[model samples]
Target: MYSGRVRPGGAPGVHELARLVVMKGVVGPLATNVYVLRDRFSGDELLIDAGAAPDRVLALAGDGPLRYLVTTHRHPDHWGALAAVAAAAPDAVTVAHEADAPAIPVPTALAVSGDGDRLTFGDVSVELIHLAGHTPGGLAVLYDDPTGPPHLWTGDSLFPGGVGKTHSAADFTSLLDDVEAKLFDRLPDETWVYPGHGDDTTLGAERPHLAAWRARGW
Candidate 1:
């Protein structure tokens, strides 16, 4: 039976790009998808959201020295294994948006602000787009690969069918507004969205339902 959740023993899959390679693995009781992005040329890597199973996450990283551990938000599901992963890579710098830095359990060595801020490792570069509402400092990592469509790691902000769950109408509005302006309006429809959980989707697939999502007021 398909429960729509990533269960334990779910194998990590790899997507290779011209300059980067992404390894996706599921962890945590919430089934958070932890992504390990590596620069093909330099072998530099970045781990996004160490949510659970430190051993599994570390194994997927292989022998490469992790340069950055980026926590998209302060949610427990996103950082469940953060401490263990950080301990494994003692030299890796922890990164988070300044707005949510104080809430992060681990020490954030780099507090990023503004959409223009970019993080680079070897030839791979990722642009950080701050999308609030899901969390005050929720960030979506954008990788503009020359070989393929742009890749966006949205965390819990934007998902396949709709936006992430929000507690209030105001919060939902804020998230929807940010997604439309910063993501859908600016990026191409072909852009690939790898969310915090579940399967991946494209912006094009979800573009038409924007109005429907708003009408329901979820």
Candidate 2:
């Protein structure tokens, strides 16, 4: 179990939003990221991507209720622990995009679509941004804190060096276009991106590389 104020190697540390505390840890053989978002006021928590080691993931929730178990996408590595975690927290609602719901291993209570659909717990609200192409239902969560820059939880759609890998040239183009228009075009440079795996990066760090990524064809 990992518990600390910061992750090593300069990845994003524990971030305090307006009313939430965010912590991240690597889980599963694929090293998928599992993020715990705790509402400081209500002690309610949301677990993002229960990829592996259900016991370890559940332990991270502490004494608060696990209100939501969110699967960023339908990939096996991203929801490998969903069954176990959902069984443990029966009250927690399972969430995923409607298009990807059929592919998920567990039953999802909330099949969300469109952009700006909000899920609130206590005073914290997370908005869903639809970013298709990586998958038909690819999505990223946007945490808009009144006091800090927005935090984006991009599943595998957007990453540090480039967008997620696609099955074809058309898919790659689609992923890149959606990412540029929905994320980079709309959010500020200071927006922090926490991808499904690996280190975190900011929109500013990736903005200049758009053309390079386009030329490389993913």
Winner by TM-score? 1
Please list the Cα RMSD from the true structure of every candidate, rounded to 1 decimal place. Answer: 2.7, 3.1
Q: Write the per-residue lDDT of candidate 2 for residues 77-169, one digit (tens) a residue.
A: 999999999999899999999999999979889999777788887678899888888898888999877888888999999888999989988
Candidate 1 displacement at residue 192 in angstroms: 0.7
Cα error, candidate 1, residue 118 (Å)? 0.5
lDDT: worst 10-residue window of model 2: 1-10
Cα miss at 50, model 2 (Å)? 0.4
Indicate the TM-score of model 2: 0.92
Candidate 2, superposed: residue stretches over 4 Å from native: 1-13
How much lDDT does each candidate structure score?
Answer: 0.89, 0.85
Pairs with steric clashes in candidate 2: none
Q: Model 2, residue 180: what's the lDDT? A: 94
